[model samples]
Every structure is written in structure tokens, then in C-alpha cells.
Target: MSQPTVPPLPQIFNFLQLAAQNPTQYGGNAADAPELTRILQEIRDLSIPNGAQHSAQGLEPYQSIARANNPTWNARPDLRPKISKFRIVKHTHWGKAYWSPVDLLGLFFSRLEPAPLGATVRTFFLPMTALFGRWAFQLVGHYAGMQSCMWKIQDNGPAQFFLGASIVGYDADIPTCGNWRRVIQKARYSLLPNESLFLRDWSFANSPHGPIHPKDDYPLGNCAELYPYLHLLRGVDESNKNVYGIALKKKGVRSPSYNDTLQGSVWQNVQWPCVKCRELIHIQEGVLANFAPYAGSKGAPP
Candidate 1:
């Protein structure tokens, strides 16, 4: 079945007067007709997922990692798990993008309560906190996605250097079961944390947890976003060396040095981070986020 056509945005809305045919409608034409039409088309394209859509995807609720593993919010019934597992189609395939200034402005109004889930149960989250700036991307025992960057300063520094994160978790309140695929198109700043080896070892690789073949190490292994900021995800110890107490790297992840070995886009699946890897990454990042202190190599405010 086809989605119904969304009504185009009217030109000359309010006092803005975008694309006026007469030129006298609002003193002078503000924007071109093509541009106004494009504006409407953008809104028409925003495919924000409904709650059922989210549930069907089997997006995890954060109860697995919340304080004392508490059930934060419970729906009366878990939407019967949809047989078609989740996959990362392109943003255009999903038709999810902001339309106009209204959508941009609406970003501020949305609330994405930032929490560390890259390690476990923060269900797919990206918060508006990215806009406020300077807060750490707190990763605990689980990895939950959020709008955070590598803060290179501000432990006590008078000035903060890192630029701000883009608007995250804006369109919806992505519950614990929402927001994990980590390959958000508009939000590149968001990190992709799914790097479990068994995830990539599907077709050509062995799964007893051994060195992954090149074919099996594609998605999170080549991740461009997380490679640079993983230190932020893994906090520092008192002595300051990258502490890898969570899981054995070779057993769990694909490669140790993705920075030098990175070839192409991170998680390059048509829909990125396969279902197996998605679940694993969430669990892995969930555990990794819980470590105390920033990573030993954790930049003081990079």
C-alpha cells in the first residue's frame, strides 16, 4: 500500500510571504516558488516512526541498564515482535528529514534526555543536549546513543573548545526501544557503537569468536564516527591508559586500530549494523559506558 500524499506547505504563510506570484502579496517575493515547493516537500517527507513501528523493530527498552535495571516506562503490551528484523536503509528510503525553519525550531522544543547507553539499555536515543554543549558522553556498562562529542577541555579549564553537537532526538521521544541503528543521516555526529565480531561474521567468517575475516569486519569495524570518539565512550582511569576491562577486544571486536585501517563509510550495510550486531553492540556499549572516569587516553577537552 502507498502512503497518502501529504499536503504541500502553503506559500505566504504568516508574514514571511515565501514565493508570492503577484509580488505585492507581501511587499515583495521572499523566496522563489521552487524553494517554497521544496519546503513543503521536505515536510511531506519526514517519516517519523510511530510507536508501533518502533516496537516492531524490537528496539530495546533501557530497563536492562537503568539504575538497578528499573523499568522506566512500560507499555501495556509489547507489540508482537515483527518477523522482518530491523535493517538500516538510507534516510531517503526512510524519508526522514526536517522540512523548514519550523522543523529546525521544533528541534529545541523536543526533549532527548541524554543518558549513556552505548553500553546497555538507553534504547536508541539522541538528545538535544548536543546543542547545549560541554557535557561528557557518559558511557556506562551499556551504550546508549546521544548527542555528545569528544570534549578536549573543561575538566577545570576556563574555556570549552569543542564545538556543539547538532539537534538530536528532536522529532520524537525515542523510547528505550527507539533509536539504535547509529547511522542517522542528518546526525552524523551521533556515534555508531556496534562492533561485536560475531555480527560481521555472518556469511564468510567463523563465529566461535576468533579473528574476523575482512568480509566479516565491515560495518562497525570501518566506523568513521566512533573511531575518533571511542575514547569519550570509554572513560579514563586514575593513571590514564585506555582501560579495556569490559570484554576481550580480539574476542569481541573486529580490529584494534580502525583509525589507520579505516577504509570506507562506517557500518556500510544497505541498512547498517545487522540485527545480530545491533543487539550485540548495544549490549557491548552498555557495559563499556559504565566504567568510571573518562578513557585514559581521554582527551582533556579535545
Candidate 2:
């Protein structure tokens, strides 16, 4: 007697469809419950070539628009050298200067494709300080608050820094604030040669302050609320090197969506240091602390 043959992918999908239609014909285990089986079949069907064809057809218009407006819509793989040579700037505040252990761990764990539930849970518990620092950097440092250390990318070049507006969409005029209206408008407009665009899906209603409209009127002025970490766009080739290409908008008469509601600046292609640089920074920090003059001593470096 011959051994039973394993089914091909299409055949497997057909079997799932049949099992979903008639659950009793299968083992009827909990995994093959009617609802679960139906969902699995639906997913399988969507993965087929025909389903993909339909999806592509539906997205054709959007793709055309994106290509026309965004230079990076179908950008060739960036072949720039990985930023291995870099220095970390020491900040007065440690939290502001370096990513916390939890923040770094969370970022690492998130890159695990098809991560397990336990790993996801652990990643979620990481502190919000990293996000807070990002927000503060945008609101305080970029606006009218204290200046802080920014990362250097190449030798003797201007410091590359992260700005929230670069990650979250913002009005061309309000450089630091994130607004859905401006995001939508930019999606439709043609991007300038220097502008680089990225699309991110956001749900303002799901934020801690509860459901709110982008145009809601507040008594004291509508200040954006702080949100938890999602994901940062890193270089595809150098996953460890956090960097984005900067997009600068041209000066023009303001549109309604581009109203200057806030005072701040935006930057693009911001690069954060790699693990090795971070470790060296920690060591440097230790040395600085140890060699520092005694507190309350005269003529000590500030």
C-alpha cells in the first residue's frame, strides 16, 4: 500500500473552503469551529492571485497619484553606506540623551516578524519616556524651549535630529503639529523635488483624550495630546541605524490647511545611533560622571 499524499496549497485551500461550508465533514475540533474555519477560508481566498488582481485594480488610482506626487513612492533601494561612524552627543538629562533599556528592548522585539504573544506583551510594557522625549524635542527644543544634543550623521556635517512632525504628518505651516487635514491634503498635492513623503495610518479617536475632531475648538487652544509609541521608520538596509530622508517644503502663500497655528521647525532623514554607539555613549557617560569635580566646588565645568 502507498502512503497518503499531502495536498498542494490550492487543494488545501479548497479543503478549507469545503470544511468551512460543512464543518461536520472535518474533525470538528475547536480549531475548525465554523466561525474560525470561515475566517481562515476568507483569508486563504484573499491570498489567491485573483484576489490580488482585484486589489491592485482598486488601488490603481491611488498608486498613480502617489507616484506622481511622492518621489519615494516607488523609490529604488537606497544603496547609501550604513552609518557605522557616528558619535552620540551627551545631554544634561540622561533620559533625553539615551534610549532607556526598555525602549531599546521594545524596538528590537518589535522587528521580530510574526512575533509571539508573549514577546508582543513584553514590548508593550516598555516605558513611554522615549515617546515623551520625542514629543518634548518637537514642542520644547524645536519651538522655544531648551536646546539639546542632536545626532551627527557624517564627519563635520550638521546634526541630524528626529522631529515628531517628520514621523507624524503636519501642516506645511505648523511644522511641529500633527493634523489629519494637512495629511490628507498633502496626499493629493504634488510633492516638490526636495520633499519626501511618508503615509501613516492614525486613529485620533482612539487616543487617551477620547474621540475628538481635527477641527475641534478648544478654549485655551487645541494642544495635541501625547500618544504611545508605535513604530519608527528605519533604513531598510541598516535596521539598527535609525534614519529618514528629510523633505523640506517651499515657502508659499498659505492654504487653509497649512495655517501657521504653531511655531516650530521640521527635519527629515533623522538618524539615531546604533547599538554600539549607544553602548559607547553609556561608557562615556560613566567616565564623565566619575571624573567630574566635586559638587559645589568653584570653577567646575557646567
Report lDDT per candidate.
0.25, 0.24
Q: List runs of model 1 lying over 4 Å from the truth.
A: 1-32, 44-165, 170-181, 185-302
**Tens digit of per-residue lDDT, candidate 2, span 20-64:** 565544334344355444343333323323433112452332110
**Strongest candidate by TM-score:** 1
TM-scores, one per candidate: 0.20, 0.18
In terms of lDDT, model 2 sits at: 0.24
True-structure Cα RMSD, model 2: 23.8
Compared with the true structure, what per-residue lDDT tens digits does model 1 show for residues 257-293? 1121112111110122223323333443433332211
State how far residue 18 of model 1 sits from its true place (Å).
3.3
